[model samples]
Target: MLVIRGLGSQYGRISVLRSVNLVIGRHQLIALVGANGAGKTTLLRTISGVQKASSGQIEFDGKDITQLRADKRVKIGICHAPEGRHVFGPLSVEDNLHLGAYSRADKAEIAADLERNYAMFPVLKQKARLPAGTLSGGQQQMLAIARALMGRPRLLLLDEPSMGLAPLLVEEIFNAVTELRKRKITILLVEQNANAALAIADQAYVMETGEIVLSGSGKELLGNERVREAYLGI
Candidate 1:
């Protein structure tokens, strides 16, 4: 449903992504795994229109959207849950979630989606009136994902969803992501945790130094010698 071709981006004189090409099929979970400085986040940011690409094409569902603004991308069903769960600290959990649906005009649909998000993340329902900043790290991450869902995204971009949580919380987050896939939400997951990311991905890509170095079925890449040594820690 999403296609990126010959994508290149630079920060001033320093190029971060070079001719990056990728395609995500409808309702598929595609994982992008790489170490620090591998341009994974940069690629997502560029796709979401938060960062400008020096050259390349970004097409979503057959529409060329490389020049679209970030908010416009969100309206087009591209919701990004950034690395840091940037929730509004002072806002109530319910309020934070409501903000996510700001792009929509239907108040009734927004309210219904809010209920669905609460059902998806029960913890959010329990903390509906509490300030977002008062929640635990794991809860905050849940809130972030829940908030994104409030936007009714067709293509979700998740950057390091398991970053600072405990192992159990990481498992919970991954499980939630897997559930989202079952619901047919197309996902582009950028993660440093290769094992977890690949475990649930339909397809996986390994990147190095701003370029795709490996692409394969998740199981195929998981068993690869180089991937085993570098990412799987086998």
Candidate 2:
């Protein structure tokens, strides 16, 4: 559904991503795992059109979108749930979710999707009128993902969804991700938790110093000696 070829990005003269190539087939969950500075988030930002590519190509369903604006990309079915659950602090939970579908005019579908999101995160329904900032970290993350789903994204980009949550919350978030993939939402998950990410991914890529070092089936990378020693701490 998406293809990135020889993609590169930089912050002024400092290069952050170099020749990054990846593909996400329809209905697949692809994980990008690396250390803190490995540029996984940069790659996602570039693909989502928030970070401009210094070089290379980004194609979605056969059309080039390398130069498309961020909002345009979202309208084209690319939605990003950023690292920090940057929910609108003063907005009610329901209001925050409604903003996700601001690009669409289909009120009936939007209402149905809102209910779907509420069903996915029952706490959201309970806190429908509460300020987003009042929710716990885990609940905020749930709201973030739920908000993105409100866009009816064809390709969801998730960066560090489990970042600071408790173990149980992390499990809940990951399980929700798995369910999304099962429902055939194509996802590109950028995670620091290598073992957990690889465990759930249909495919996985290992990145180092702004370059992808290895690509394989998730289980294959999970059992790899180098991956075990470096990322998994095995």
Candidate 3:
């Protein structure tokens, strides 16, 4: 449902993503695994239109969106849950979620999706009236993902969803992601946890120094000698 060809981006003169190419079929979970500086997050940001592309093309479904405005991209069904859990500190948890649906005008569907998000993260429902900053780290992460869902995204870009969470919370978050894919959400997952990301991904890519180094089935990459030694520490 999404295609990126020869994608390149930079932070001023410093290049971050170079000649990157990737595709995500409908309802597929595509995991992108790489080290901290491999430019996984930059690739996602460029796709979501938050960061401008220095070169190359980004197409969603079919049309080119390389130069689309960030908010327009969200309206076109590209939603990003960024690296940090940047929730509105003073807003109520429910309000933050409501803000996600600001681009849409379907009140009935928005309300229904609100319940769906609440069901997805019961903690958010319990803390509906509380300030988002009051929630625990794990809960805040849940809120971030749930808020993104409120936008009714077709292609969800999740970056470091499990960063800093406890092991159990990490498991919970991954399980929730799996559930999301099962419901036909196409996802581009950028994760530091190689093992977990590869295990759940339908397809996976390995990036090094701003370019794709390997692309294969998730299990194939999981068992690769180089991948095992470098990312998995096996």
Clash numbers, per candidate: 0, 0, 0
What are the models' TM-scores?
A: 0.98, 0.99, 0.99
- In the range 1-234, model 2's lDDT, one tens digit per residue, is 999999999999999999999989999999999999999999989988889999999999999999999999999999999989899999999999999998999999999999988888899999999999999999999999999999999999999999999999999999899999989999999998999999999999998999999999999999999999999999
* Global lDDT of model 3: 0.95
Clashing pairs in 3: none
After superposition, which runs of candidate 3 have C-alpha atoms over 4 Å from their true positions? none
lDDT of 2: 0.95
Worst 10 residues of 2 by lDDT: 114-123
**What tens digits encode model 3's per-residue C-alpha lDDT throughout 131-233?**
9999999999999999899999999999999999999999999999999998999999999999999999999999999999999999999999999999999
* Cα-based lDDT for every prediction: 0.93, 0.95, 0.95
Evaluation by TM-score, superior candidate among 1 and 3? 3
RMSD of each: 0.9, 0.7, 0.6
- Supply candidate 2's per-residue lDDT for 77: 98
